[model samples]
Target: MPEVQRIVFAGTPDFAARPLQQLLDAGVRPVAVYTQPDRPAGRGRQASASPVKQTAVAAGLPVFQPPHFRDQTSLDELQALQPDLMIVVAYGLLLPTAVLTTPRLGCINVHASLLPRWRGAAPIQRALEAGDTESGVTLMQMDAGLDTGPMIAERRLPLPATMTGGELHDALAELGAQLLLETLPDIEQKLAAARPQPDTGVTYAHKLSKQEGQLDWQQSAQALANRVRAFNPWPVCWFEWQGKPVRVWSAQADSAEATRPGTVRRSDERLYIATGDGWLELLQVQPAGKKAMPVADWLRGSGQALQSGEVLT
Candidate 1:
């Protein structure tokens, strides 16, 4: 395989940042790094740099934050770098043909899925939500279509029955970085003979929205439990209680006698709520504007006088 020279890196989040760090660790320096513009984040809504930008800045590499690259000016700037290869991961923008063809060896993407499956924005969360048994990363040669690229290499990991989206995301990020390091040496050859993605088993992982977190008690307990895991640490699974929103941080489901869904049933200190088919026990929760606490803690403190018959919305 020929040595890659003057590579351009494009990415935005922590997933992308890890691989760039790994490349740096391996003494591979990028000619330029491209990341999204700083955006407001946290409770204060302060403008913050993306993880990729942070890594690039810390490494003293030049960074670009073009809102889009379709314009000729942006295209010109990218061309000036004279990249041999472009590595993209969660870059959050589509690369036009001009930009794609600019690199000598072409643009290669480190996608967070075994392509032809979970081929869009929220692959990790979608896999967990669907109760998939396995998950993996795919290194591919970029094409115009969404994740519709010829794959070069892939690495897999088994999905635990109760894995959370956050857990899977972190694990996959590291796994992707490791895979990138191992695959880089053979990248040129792999690209020359990249395999086309199969049309079967192709699924789109739609981007998650805050509205999806609103829990629907009519859904089966197992389904809700899966969603609870998939939406954690984001728009956390929630339901209204006493006209206020209550976020469920952790929970488990149990098969039980049929009852009105959303009815609260107490057994000692445990808080179990009836679902369409079973009971979902709330392990941890956050009442609107309050810090998350164990259900037992909330029951003993703020909910000491509350009885079992109330229904959650």
Candidate 2:
């Protein structure tokens, strides 16, 4: 067996943690880990640890949290690691040419979507939001351009109609780990080859915003269902209910509502909202700070039934 190389790992969210753990389990020694700085999160607005930081700590690795990678001190500190290779996954930060060229093997990224399509942040969410039938992960070299690196490896995953962003995220995370391990030997031996992405078929996946999560009841239930799945864990799909916010967790298409868009109609054991061509069934929902509940339970608990002519924004 060949000797292991010194790796400097960079990533921030849970999507990046799995492959980092895989590299460690594969006997590659990481000199240092880089992740985003902790910021306020959750209901109390407390500073929270990033998933990558937690994983690195549990693995007993040195961790570096930097607000950005532009200053002289941080660059010097990272260069001091003397890494043979840098493995980056969902790091959520752009790497300058100096940092990119620091490692002997250069920096490799684990992107959630296949290259040339959905080539930016929030790829998984954007794919689902756009109603794509399939999405896959691709491993590539890191360039100054966003996800424009040359590809070293690729693996495809099915995007089932029932898959939520959280579910797809976990599936891809596991698949990405396996792919990384398989590619390492080739990379170490200088046998791995990369192909440049084509100019055609390129699309940028902009980051998800709070506004994108708002449900427009006028759309077909199928469209709303996709939104419900795409935004499950963050900026969740929601609508207004008598001027209050109600987050939708799961939804399905129906065809029985006779009222206008945003009209909340009820049937036994179900809640239906009308659309231009179909109706949407709200399976689960969260009312503000309260826990998620079945629509039936929510309707009963609130001591109020959703009535017609109510506009949800």
Candidate 3:
């Protein structure tokens, strides 16, 4: 194994921050940290530092926030660091070939999904949406292609039937952190032994959009239920109800007979929506301008007079 000195880290978001924090906690601090530039966030739309930048700042590490490494000046600045190795996790920027080879040992990325699968943005959500029974983290040697890197190390985690995207994200973040820590001790050896990902079974996890969160009643009830789990804590799944959008936070698939695709029924204090195959039981939902609550609570309160056989578009 080669002696790893002067490490550089590049990442953004909470998922990336966790591994950076773990590195610091383990006394393997990076010489410099690179993150995306501050951007407008939240309802205020005020400039806010990314989670990795915030963590770097708190640790008194040198922080660089370049919009993208498209300029010669940015590339020169990174080259000046003379990093022995660079660790990237959810950095949200495509690194050019120059940056990839700048480091002595090259750059490595901590991706959320197993390589040749979910090889783009929104992997966690995509995995849940597809109803995969298992998910894992992959540490790969970075290449020019998008997440098309050779695998250095990987760790798998079983997915329960009720796992949500948010839940899986948190789990995989910590798992990735642990995997990175373990790989660092023998990084050179692992890199030397890294294997190319198989071309078969490849699937891209396309970036998510708010429009995709709209529930399609024509889909199977189980599929709709999976979507509800996949999209939670994000552009949550929703349906139009009386000219307003009702967000479905949590739901379950049932074998109840289907009526019209979008028809809704109330029974035994539970709310059910008919789908192509069966029914989807709405466990939690949020009205257009209200907080999310259980189906029973919503039924007793604002949804008291919700008529059975009412259709949700």
Q: How many steric clashes between backbone atoms does each model show? A: 0, 0, 0
What's the candidate order when arranged by decreasing TM-score? 3, 1, 2
* lDDT per residue as tens, model 2, 186-271: 78553246888889989999989988898887788888888899998988998876678889999988866446787766765678
Tens digit of per-residue lDDT, candidate 1, span 1-313: 4578889999999989999999999999999999999999999999999999999999999999999987999999988998889999899998899999999899999888888899999999888888888999999999889999899999999998788889988999998999889988878888888999998999999999999999998888888888898888776899887678889988888888748998888855899888998989888889888899999988887766557988877
The regions of model 1 sitting more than 4 angstroms off are none
Clashing pairs in 1: none
RMSD of each: 1.3, 2.3, 0.9
Residue 120, candidate 2: how far off, in angstroms? Answer: 1.2
Runs of candidate 2 exceeding 4 Å displacement: 1-4, 43-46, 188-192, 255-259, 308-313
Candidate 3 residue lDDT tens string, 1-313: 5599889999999999999999999999899999999999999999999999999999999999998889999999999999999999999999999999999999999999988899999999999999999999999999999899899999999999898889999999999999999999989999999999998989999999999999999999999999999998898999887778989999999987899998888965899989999999999999999999998998998888787988877
**TM-score of model 2 (CA atoms):** 0.92
Query: What would the TM-scores of all predictions be?
Result: 0.96, 0.92, 0.98
Look at candidate 3 and give me any clashing residue pairs. Answer: none
The CA lDDT at 43 in model 1 is 100
Q: What C-alpha lDDT do the candidate models reach, one value each?
A: 0.90, 0.85, 0.94
Highest lDDT scorer = 3
